[model samples]
Target: MTMDGKVALVTGGSRGLGMRMVTAFAALGADVIIASRKLENCEKLAQFVGEEYGRKALPVACNVSDWEQCDALVAAAYAEFGRVDVLVNNAGLSPLYPSLDQVGEGLWDKVIGINLKGPFRLSSLIGTRMAAGDGGSIINISSMAAIRPAPEHLPYAAAKAGLNALTEGLAQAFGPTVRVNGIQCGAFLTDISEAWTPEVVEVLTRDVALGRCGEPDEVVGAAVYFATEASSFATGATLRLDGGVR
Candidate 1:
Protein backbone atom coordinates (compact mmCIF):
# COMPACT_ATOMS: atom_id res chain seq x y z
CA MET A 1 0.00 0.00 0.00
CA THR A 2 1.41 3.31 -1.05
CA MET A 3 0.34 6.39 0.91
CA ASP A 4 2.72 8.59 -1.15
CA GLY A 5 1.58 12.05 -0.05
CA LYS A 6 -1.00 11.22 2.59
CA VAL A 7 -1.03 12.43 6.17
CA ALA A 8 -1.66 10.03 9.06
CA LEU A 9 -2.44 10.86 12.64
CA VAL A 10 -2.02 8.19 15.31
CA THR A 11 -2.82 8.49 18.98
CA GLY A 12 -0.54 6.65 21.44
CA GLY A 13 2.15 6.64 18.81
CA SER A 14 4.92 7.07 21.37
CA ARG A 15 5.46 3.40 22.08
CA GLY A 16 4.40 -0.22 21.54
CA LEU A 17 1.87 -0.99 18.77
CA GLY A 18 1.27 2.72 18.27
CA MET A 19 4.96 3.34 17.67
CA ARG A 20 5.18 0.42 15.24
CA MET A 21 2.21 1.71 13.27
CA VAL A 22 3.71 5.18 13.21
CA THR A 23 6.88 3.79 11.70
CA ALA A 24 5.03 1.65 9.17
CA PHE A 25 2.96 4.64 8.01
CA ALA A 26 6.06 6.77 7.57
CA ALA A 27 7.75 4.01 5.63
CA LEU A 28 4.80 3.96 3.28
CA GLY A 29 5.60 7.59 2.40
CA ALA A 30 3.01 9.34 4.56
CA ASP A 31 3.64 12.33 6.72
CA VAL A 32 2.82 11.27 10.27
CA ILE A 33 1.56 12.99 13.38
CA ILE A 34 2.48 11.01 16.49
CA ALA A 35 0.47 12.03 19.54
CA SER A 36 0.79 10.76 23.09
CA ARG A 37 0.65 11.97 26.66
CA LYS A 38 4.38 12.59 26.89
CA LEU A 39 5.97 15.14 24.60
CA GLU A 40 9.45 13.74 25.08
CA ASN A 41 8.57 10.26 23.87
CA CYS A 42 6.54 11.53 20.93
CA GLU A 43 9.31 13.84 19.85
CA LYS A 44 11.82 11.04 20.00
CA LEU A 45 9.72 8.90 17.63
CA ALA A 46 9.07 11.85 15.32
CA GLN A 47 12.77 12.55 15.01
CA PHE A 48 13.58 8.91 14.35
CA VAL A 49 10.94 8.59 11.65
CA GLY A 50 12.15 11.75 9.96
CA GLU A 51 15.76 10.69 10.03
CA GLU A 52 15.25 7.06 9.08
CA TYR A 53 12.29 7.14 6.72
CA GLY A 54 12.73 10.62 5.30
CA ARG A 55 9.09 11.31 5.95
CA LYS A 56 7.87 14.32 7.91
CA ALA A 57 6.80 13.50 11.45
CA LEU A 58 5.22 15.76 14.05
CA PRO A 59 5.19 14.97 17.72
CA VAL A 60 2.26 16.41 19.63
CA ALA A 61 1.47 16.06 23.30
CA CYS A 62 -2.09 14.91 23.87
CA ASN A 63 -3.94 13.28 26.72
CA VAL A 64 -7.05 11.83 25.07
CA SER A 65 -8.73 11.33 28.44
CA ASP A 66 -9.51 15.07 28.37
CA TRP A 67 -12.08 16.50 25.97
CA GLU A 68 -10.16 19.74 25.71
CA GLN A 69 -7.00 17.87 24.84
CA CYS A 70 -8.79 15.86 22.19
CA ASP A 71 -10.03 19.06 20.61
CA ALA A 72 -6.58 20.56 20.74
CA LEU A 73 -5.09 17.41 19.18
CA VAL A 74 -7.47 17.66 16.22
CA ALA A 75 -6.76 21.34 15.75
CA ALA A 76 -3.03 20.79 15.89
CA ALA A 77 -3.13 17.97 13.33
CA TYR A 78 -5.15 20.01 10.87
CA ALA A 79 -3.03 23.07 11.47
CA GLU A 80 0.19 21.24 10.69
CA PHE A 81 -0.82 18.86 7.90
CA GLY A 82 -3.74 20.75 6.40
CA ARG A 83 -5.57 17.42 6.41
CA VAL A 84 -5.35 13.91 7.73
CA ASP A 85 -6.11 11.00 5.43
CA VAL A 86 -5.87 8.36 8.12
CA LEU A 87 -6.69 8.55 11.81
CA VAL A 88 -5.85 5.69 14.21
CA ASN A 89 -7.32 5.79 17.71
CA ASN A 90 -4.84 3.52 19.45
CA ALA A 91 -4.39 5.09 22.85
CA GLY A 92 -5.64 2.94 25.72
CA LEU A 93 -5.26 2.37 29.46
CA SER A 94 -5.85 -0.81 31.49
CA PRO A 95 -4.28 -0.61 34.89
CA LEU A 96 -3.89 -3.81 36.87
CA TYR A 97 -5.33 -4.38 40.31
CA PRO A 98 -5.13 -7.29 42.72
CA SER A 99 -8.89 -7.75 42.92
CA LEU A 100 -12.15 -6.59 41.38
CA ASP A 101 -13.12 -5.24 44.78
CA GLN A 102 -10.20 -2.86 44.52
CA VAL A 103 -11.56 -1.22 41.34
CA GLY A 104 -12.50 2.37 42.02
CA GLU A 105 -14.63 5.01 40.35
CA GLY A 106 -11.55 6.84 39.19
CA LEU A 107 -10.09 3.76 37.52
CA TRP A 108 -13.33 2.95 35.74
CA ASP A 109 -13.78 6.53 34.63
CA LYS A 110 -10.25 6.87 33.31
CA VAL A 111 -10.37 3.60 31.39
CA ILE A 112 -13.77 4.33 29.85
CA GLY A 113 -12.98 7.95 29.09
CA ILE A 114 -9.75 7.22 27.30
CA ASN A 115 -10.79 4.02 25.54
CA LEU A 116 -14.27 5.06 24.44
CA LYS A 117 -14.90 8.79 24.73
CA GLY A 118 -11.59 9.79 23.23
CA PRO A 119 -12.17 7.97 19.94
CA PHE A 120 -15.74 9.22 19.69
CA ARG A 121 -14.64 12.84 19.92
CA LEU A 122 -11.62 12.45 17.71
CA SER A 123 -13.45 10.51 14.99
CA SER A 124 -16.45 12.85 15.02
CA LEU A 125 -14.21 15.87 14.68
CA ILE A 126 -11.83 14.45 12.10
CA GLY A 127 -14.27 12.33 10.13
CA THR A 128 -16.53 15.31 9.54
CA ARG A 129 -13.71 17.24 7.94
CA MET A 130 -12.60 14.19 6.02
CA ALA A 131 -16.07 13.69 4.56
CA ALA A 132 -16.25 17.35 3.60
CA GLY A 133 -12.82 17.57 2.10
CA ASP A 134 -10.98 14.76 0.28
CA GLY A 135 -12.28 11.93 2.49
CA GLY A 136 -10.38 9.64 4.89
CA SER A 137 -10.38 6.55 7.11
CA ILE A 138 -10.70 6.07 10.86
CA ILE A 139 -9.46 2.96 12.62
CA ASN A 140 -10.42 2.19 16.20
CA ILE A 141 -8.18 -0.17 18.14
CA SER A 142 -10.22 -2.62 20.17
CA SER A 143 -9.34 -5.64 22.28
CA MET A 144 -10.55 -9.22 22.82
CA ALA A 145 -11.43 -8.32 26.36
CA ALA A 146 -14.42 -6.61 24.81
CA ILE A 147 -15.84 -9.95 23.74
CA ARG A 148 -14.59 -12.14 26.59
CA PRO A 149 -14.07 -10.23 29.77
CA ALA A 150 -11.94 -11.61 32.57
CA PRO A 151 -12.73 -10.57 36.12
CA GLU A 152 -9.49 -8.67 36.37
CA HIS A 153 -10.03 -6.62 33.23
CA LEU A 154 -13.73 -5.92 33.42
CA PRO A 155 -13.46 -2.16 33.14
CA TYR A 156 -11.07 -2.28 30.22
CA ALA A 157 -13.15 -4.90 28.45
CA ALA A 158 -16.31 -2.86 28.88
CA ALA A 159 -14.60 0.20 27.48
CA LYS A 160 -13.30 -1.73 24.48
CA ALA A 161 -16.76 -3.10 23.80
CA GLY A 162 -17.96 0.49 23.76
CA LEU A 163 -15.22 1.27 21.29
CA ASN A 164 -16.42 -1.49 18.95
CA ALA A 165 -19.91 -0.01 19.10
CA LEU A 166 -18.52 3.43 18.35
CA THR A 167 -16.75 2.09 15.28
CA GLU A 168 -19.98 0.82 13.74
CA GLY A 169 -21.91 3.97 14.59
CA LEU A 170 -19.23 6.26 13.22
CA ALA A 171 -19.08 4.24 10.01
CA GLN A 172 -22.75 4.96 9.41
CA ALA A 173 -22.41 8.57 10.45
CA PHE A 174 -19.47 9.23 8.12
CA GLY A 175 -20.48 7.10 5.18
CA PRO A 176 -19.54 7.54 1.49
CA THR A 177 -16.58 9.79 2.17
CA VAL A 178 -15.12 8.66 5.47
CA ARG A 179 -14.83 4.98 6.37
CA VAL A 180 -14.76 3.72 9.94
CA ASN A 181 -13.53 0.29 11.03
CA GLY A 182 -12.06 -1.48 14.03
CA ILE A 183 -9.28 -3.94 14.91
CA GLN A 184 -10.27 -6.18 17.83
CA CYS A 185 -6.80 -6.97 19.02
CA GLY A 186 -5.74 -9.97 21.10
CA ALA A 187 -2.71 -10.35 23.35
CA PHE A 188 0.47 -8.74 22.03
CA LEU A 189 3.80 -7.97 23.65
CA THR A 190 3.18 -4.30 24.00
CA ASP A 191 4.00 -2.10 26.97
CA ILE A 192 1.41 -3.96 28.99
CA SER A 193 3.09 -7.31 28.39
CA GLU A 194 5.53 -6.75 31.23
CA ALA A 195 2.80 -7.80 33.63
CA TRP A 196 2.24 -11.16 31.96
CA THR A 197 3.78 -13.95 33.97
CA PRO A 198 4.68 -17.43 32.69
CA GLU A 199 1.46 -18.83 34.09
CA VAL A 200 -0.57 -16.09 32.52
CA VAL A 201 1.11 -16.57 29.16
CA GLU A 202 0.56 -20.30 29.29
CA VAL A 203 -3.12 -19.87 29.97
CA LEU A 204 -3.56 -17.21 27.27
CA THR A 205 -1.99 -19.32 24.53
CA ARG A 206 -3.44 -22.64 25.57
CA ASP A 207 -6.51 -22.43 23.41
CA VAL A 208 -5.35 -19.84 20.94
CA ALA A 209 -5.03 -21.01 17.35
CA LEU A 210 -1.70 -19.23 16.97
CA GLY A 211 -0.41 -20.33 20.37
CA ARG A 212 1.49 -17.14 21.20
CA CYS A 213 1.23 -13.42 21.65
CA GLY A 214 1.44 -11.22 18.56
CA GLU A 215 4.24 -8.91 17.59
CA PRO A 216 3.77 -5.16 17.40
CA ASP A 217 4.43 -5.00 13.66
CA GLU A 218 1.88 -7.70 12.93
CA VAL A 219 -0.86 -5.08 13.36
CA VAL A 220 0.50 -2.81 10.64
CA GLY A 221 -0.89 -4.88 7.75
CA ALA A 222 -4.47 -4.66 9.00
CA ALA A 223 -4.09 -0.96 9.67
CA VAL A 224 -2.74 -0.33 6.20
CA TYR A 225 -5.58 -2.30 4.65
CA PHE A 226 -8.07 -0.10 6.44
CA ALA A 227 -6.26 3.16 5.69
CA THR A 228 -5.81 2.74 1.95
CA GLU A 229 -8.10 2.14 -1.03
CA ALA A 230 -7.92 -1.61 -0.45
CA SER A 231 -10.71 -1.41 2.09
CA SER A 232 -12.76 1.26 0.33
CA PHE A 233 -15.77 -0.99 0.08
CA ALA A 234 -15.42 -2.14 3.66
CA THR A 235 -16.88 -0.07 6.49
CA GLY A 236 -18.42 -0.68 9.87
CA ALA A 237 -16.37 -3.88 10.02
CA THR A 238 -14.39 -5.17 12.97
CA LEU A 239 -11.47 -7.48 12.17
CA ARG A 240 -9.98 -9.62 14.91
CA LEU A 241 -6.19 -9.52 15.25
CA ASP A 242 -5.76 -11.67 18.31
CA GLY A 243 -4.01 -14.79 16.93
CA GLY A 244 -7.38 -16.43 16.23
CA VAL A 245 -8.30 -16.79 19.86
CA ARG A 246 -12.01 -17.50 19.57
Candidate 2:
Protein backbone atom coordinates (compact mmCIF):
# COMPACT_ATOMS: atom_id res chain seq x y z
CA MET A 1 0.00 0.00 0.00
CA THR A 2 2.82 2.41 -0.78
CA MET A 3 0.40 4.43 -2.85
CA ASP A 4 -2.48 4.20 -0.47
CA GLY A 5 -5.19 6.78 -1.19
CA LYS A 6 -3.43 7.92 -4.37
CA VAL A 7 -5.24 8.23 -7.69
CA ALA A 8 -3.58 7.23 -10.96
CA LEU A 9 -4.93 8.24 -14.35
CA VAL A 10 -3.54 6.14 -17.20
CA THR A 11 -4.25 6.69 -20.87
CA GLY A 12 -4.39 3.88 -23.45
CA GLY A 13 -5.00 1.85 -20.36
CA SER A 14 -7.34 -0.70 -21.88
CA ARG A 15 -4.70 -3.21 -22.93
CA GLY A 16 -1.06 -4.09 -23.48
CA LEU A 17 1.55 -2.22 -21.41
CA GLY A 18 -1.09 0.27 -20.51
CA MET A 19 -3.28 -2.42 -18.95
CA ARG A 20 -0.30 -3.75 -17.07
CA MET A 21 0.29 -0.26 -15.63
CA VAL A 22 -3.37 0.04 -14.66
CA THR A 23 -3.20 -3.22 -12.73
CA ALA A 24 0.04 -2.23 -11.04
CA PHE A 25 -1.34 1.02 -9.69
CA ALA A 26 -4.34 -0.75 -8.21
CA ALA A 27 -2.12 -3.23 -6.48
CA LEU A 28 -0.14 -0.37 -4.95
CA GLY A 29 -3.33 0.84 -3.25
CA ALA A 30 -4.17 3.55 -5.73
CA ASP A 31 -7.55 3.93 -7.34
CA VAL A 32 -7.22 3.94 -11.12
CA ILE A 33 -8.74 5.74 -14.08
CA ILE A 34 -8.50 3.51 -17.17
CA ALA A 35 -8.88 5.36 -20.45
CA SER A 36 -8.70 4.33 -24.10
CA ARG A 37 -10.75 4.36 -27.29
CA LYS A 38 -12.89 1.46 -26.13
CA LEU A 39 -15.03 1.93 -23.03
CA GLU A 40 -15.90 -1.73 -22.65
CA ASN A 41 -12.29 -2.80 -22.48
CA CYS A 42 -11.59 -0.15 -19.87
CA GLU A 43 -14.64 -1.29 -17.93
CA LYS A 44 -13.55 -4.90 -17.92
CA LEU A 45 -10.17 -4.04 -16.45
CA ALA A 46 -11.81 -1.62 -14.06
CA GLN A 47 -14.12 -4.32 -12.74
CA PHE A 48 -11.30 -6.78 -12.39
CA VAL A 49 -9.19 -4.33 -10.34
CA GLY A 50 -12.14 -3.45 -8.18
CA GLU A 51 -12.90 -7.07 -7.44
CA GLU A 52 -9.33 -8.23 -7.02
CA TYR A 53 -7.91 -5.36 -5.01
CA GLY A 54 -10.86 -3.50 -3.55
CA ARG A 55 -9.61 -0.31 -5.18
CA LYS A 56 -11.93 2.06 -6.97
CA ALA A 57 -11.48 2.01 -10.74
CA LEU A 58 -12.99 4.40 -13.25
CA PRO A 59 -13.31 3.61 -16.97
CA VAL A 60 -13.08 6.45 -19.49
CA ALA A 61 -13.33 6.23 -23.27
CA CYS A 62 -10.86 8.70 -24.70
CA ASN A 63 -9.20 9.25 -28.06
CA VAL A 64 -6.08 11.09 -26.89
CA SER A 65 -5.48 12.41 -30.39
CA ASP A 66 -8.48 14.64 -29.88
CA TRP A 67 -7.96 17.69 -27.70
CA GLU A 68 -11.59 17.66 -26.69
CA GLN A 69 -11.36 14.05 -25.57
CA CYS A 70 -8.17 14.66 -23.63
CA ASP A 71 -9.87 17.50 -21.79
CA ALA A 72 -12.90 15.39 -21.08
CA LEU A 73 -10.80 12.51 -19.84
CA VAL A 74 -9.07 14.67 -17.26
CA ALA A 75 -12.34 16.22 -16.18
CA ALA A 76 -13.84 12.77 -15.85
CA ALA A 77 -10.92 11.46 -13.82
CA TYR A 78 -11.04 14.41 -11.46
CA ALA A 79 -14.80 14.11 -11.17
CA GLU A 80 -14.53 10.51 -10.13
CA PHE A 81 -11.33 10.46 -8.13
CA GLY A 82 -11.20 14.04 -6.84
CA ARG A 83 -7.52 14.26 -7.73
CA VAL A 84 -4.93 12.49 -9.83
CA ASP A 85 -1.73 11.67 -7.97
CA VAL A 86 -0.14 9.98 -10.95
CA LEU A 87 -0.69 10.43 -14.69
CA VAL A 88 0.71 7.91 -17.19
CA ASN A 89 0.51 8.72 -20.88
CA ASN A 90 0.69 5.19 -22.25
CA ALA A 91 -1.36 5.35 -25.44
CA GLY A 92 0.47 5.47 -28.77
CA LEU A 93 0.31 4.37 -32.42
CA SER A 94 2.78 3.52 -35.22
CA PRO A 95 1.04 2.74 -38.48
CA LEU A 96 2.78 0.67 -41.13
CA TYR A 97 3.61 2.05 -44.58
CA PRO A 98 5.32 0.38 -47.47
CA SER A 99 7.73 3.27 -47.84
CA LEU A 100 8.49 6.67 -46.35
CA ASP A 101 7.21 8.32 -49.52
CA GLN A 102 3.93 6.44 -49.16
CA VAL A 103 3.22 7.86 -45.72
CA GLY A 104 0.17 10.02 -46.21
CA GLU A 105 -0.48 13.27 -44.37
CA GLY A 106 -3.55 11.71 -42.76
CA LEU A 107 -1.48 8.96 -41.21
CA TRP A 108 1.22 11.40 -40.20
CA ASP A 109 -1.25 13.60 -38.37
CA LYS A 110 -2.83 10.63 -36.66
CA VAL A 111 0.51 9.38 -35.35
CA ILE A 112 1.64 12.80 -34.17
CA GLY A 113 -1.70 13.59 -32.63
CA ILE A 114 -1.89 10.46 -30.53
CA ASN A 115 1.79 10.12 -29.77
CA LEU A 116 2.57 13.74 -28.96
CA LYS A 117 -0.33 16.17 -28.97
CA GLY A 118 -2.59 14.25 -26.60
CA PRO A 119 0.04 13.91 -23.91
CA PHE A 120 0.90 17.57 -24.30
CA ARG A 121 -2.63 18.67 -23.66
CA LEU A 122 -3.32 16.15 -20.92
CA SER A 123 -0.12 16.92 -19.04
CA SER A 124 -0.59 20.67 -19.26
CA LEU A 125 -4.05 20.41 -17.79
CA ILE A 126 -3.44 17.86 -15.05
CA GLY A 127 0.17 18.64 -14.27
CA THR A 128 -0.72 22.22 -13.50
CA ARG A 129 -3.34 21.06 -11.06
CA MET A 130 -0.96 18.56 -9.51
CA ALA A 131 1.68 21.21 -9.12
CA ALA A 132 -0.61 23.67 -7.40
CA GLY A 133 -1.93 21.21 -4.88
CA ASP A 134 -0.51 18.23 -3.00
CA GLY A 135 1.85 17.51 -5.94
CA GLY A 136 1.86 14.39 -8.19
CA SER A 137 3.80 12.58 -10.91
CA ILE A 138 3.59 12.41 -14.71
CA ILE A 139 4.93 9.46 -16.70
CA ASN A 140 5.21 9.56 -20.47
CA ILE A 141 5.54 6.17 -22.16
CA SER A 142 8.08 6.77 -24.94
CA SER A 143 9.71 4.43 -27.47
CA MET A 144 13.32 3.55 -28.28
CA ALA A 145 12.28 4.28 -31.85
CA ALA A 146 13.17 7.88 -31.10
CA ILE A 147 16.84 6.99 -30.93
CA ARG A 148 17.52 4.22 -33.44
CA PRO A 149 14.70 5.06 -35.77
CA ALA A 150 14.13 2.93 -38.86
CA PRO A 151 12.93 4.19 -42.23
CA GLU A 152 9.41 2.82 -41.89
CA HIS A 153 9.05 4.35 -38.45
CA LEU A 154 10.05 7.92 -39.24
CA PRO A 155 6.82 9.62 -38.20
CA TYR A 156 6.48 7.52 -35.07
CA ALA A 157 10.10 8.08 -34.13
CA ALA A 158 9.74 11.80 -34.68
CA ALA A 159 6.63 11.96 -32.56
CA LYS A 160 8.31 10.06 -29.74
CA ALA A 161 11.30 12.35 -29.97
CA GLY A 162 8.92 15.20 -29.41
CA LEU A 163 7.52 13.27 -26.43
CA ASN A 164 11.02 12.98 -24.98
CA ALA A 165 11.41 16.69 -25.35
CA LEU A 166 8.01 17.28 -23.81
CA THR A 167 8.98 15.12 -20.87
CA GLU A 168 11.84 17.46 -20.03
CA GLY A 169 9.77 20.56 -20.71
CA LEU A 170 6.94 19.43 -18.43
CA ALA A 171 9.38 18.48 -15.73
CA GLN A 172 10.72 21.99 -15.67
CA ALA A 173 7.31 23.57 -15.93
CA PHE A 174 5.88 21.66 -12.97
CA GLY A 175 9.06 21.48 -10.94
CA PRO A 176 9.44 22.14 -7.21
CA THR A 177 6.10 20.33 -6.94
CA VAL A 178 5.25 17.84 -9.65
CA ARG A 179 7.77 15.43 -11.14
CA VAL A 180 7.69 14.33 -14.80
CA ASN A 181 9.58 11.50 -16.48
CA GLY A 182 9.46 9.18 -19.49
CA ILE A 183 9.96 5.46 -20.00
CA GLN A 184 11.77 4.90 -23.28
CA CYS A 185 10.62 1.39 -24.04
CA GLY A 186 11.99 -1.01 -26.60
CA ALA A 187 10.12 -3.86 -28.30
CA PHE A 188 7.69 -5.62 -26.02
CA LEU A 189 5.71 -8.74 -26.87
CA THR A 190 2.39 -7.15 -26.21
CA ASP A 191 -0.74 -7.74 -28.27
CA ILE A 192 0.91 -5.71 -31.01
CA SER A 193 3.52 -8.46 -31.39
CA GLU A 194 0.91 -10.50 -33.24
CA ALA A 195 1.74 -8.27 -36.17
CA TRP A 196 5.47 -9.04 -36.09
CA THR A 197 6.85 -11.62 -38.46
CA PRO A 198 9.59 -14.02 -37.40
CA GLU A 199 12.12 -12.14 -39.51
CA VAL A 200 11.00 -8.81 -38.08
CA VAL A 201 11.22 -10.13 -34.53
CA GLU A 202 14.62 -11.59 -35.23
CA VAL A 203 15.93 -8.33 -36.61
CA LEU A 204 14.55 -6.38 -33.67
CA THR A 205 15.78 -8.78 -31.00
CA ARG A 206 19.22 -9.64 -32.31
CA ASP A 207 21.02 -6.51 -31.16
CA VAL A 208 19.56 -6.46 -27.66
CA ALA A 209 21.79 -7.66 -24.86
CA LEU A 210 18.87 -9.62 -23.47
CA GLY A 211 18.26 -11.13 -26.94
CA ARG A 212 14.49 -11.07 -26.56
CA CYS A 213 11.57 -8.70 -26.50
CA GLY A 214 10.39 -7.55 -23.06
CA GLU A 215 7.31 -8.77 -21.27
CA PRO A 216 4.48 -6.42 -20.35
CA ASP A 217 4.85 -7.21 -16.66
CA GLU A 218 8.51 -6.17 -16.62
CA VAL A 219 7.49 -2.53 -17.10
CA VAL A 220 5.52 -2.41 -13.86
CA GLY A 221 8.46 -1.91 -11.49
CA ALA A 222 9.83 1.20 -13.18
CA ALA A 223 6.31 2.56 -13.46
CA VAL A 224 5.63 2.05 -9.79
CA TYR A 225 8.94 3.61 -8.85
CA PHE A 226 8.14 6.69 -10.88
CA ALA A 227 4.69 6.83 -9.31
CA THR A 228 5.78 6.59 -5.69
CA GLU A 229 8.40 7.85 -3.23
CA ALA A 230 11.01 5.50 -4.66
CA SER A 231 11.68 8.13 -7.32
CA SER A 232 11.11 11.21 -5.21
CA PHE A 233 14.44 12.69 -6.24
CA ALA A 234 13.92 11.87 -9.92
CA THR A 235 12.34 13.99 -12.64
CA GLY A 236 12.89 15.20 -16.19
CA ALA A 237 14.53 11.85 -16.96
CA THR A 238 13.74 9.19 -19.53
CA LEU A 239 14.66 5.68 -18.39
CA ARG A 240 15.42 3.11 -21.09
CA LEU A 241 13.57 -0.18 -20.84
CA ASP A 242 14.77 -1.69 -24.12
CA GLY A 243 16.75 -4.60 -22.71
CA GLY A 244 20.06 -2.80 -23.33
CA VAL A 245 19.69 -2.44 -27.07
CA ARG A 246 23.11 -1.88 -28.56
**Alpha-carbon TM-score of each model against the true structure:** 0.98, 0.99
lDDT by residue (83-142, candidate 1, tens digit) is: 999999999998988899899899989999999989989998999999999999999999
Going through the candidates in the order shown, the clash numbers are 0, 0
- Among the numbered candidates, top lDDT falls to 2
Q: Candidate 2: deviation at residue 61, Å?
A: 0.4
Q: By TM-score, how accurate is candidate 2?
A: 0.99
Off by over 4 Å in 2: none
For residue 125, give model 1's deviation from the true position in Å.
0.5
- The alpha-carbon RMSD values of the candidates against the true structure, listed in the order shown, are 0.9, 0.8
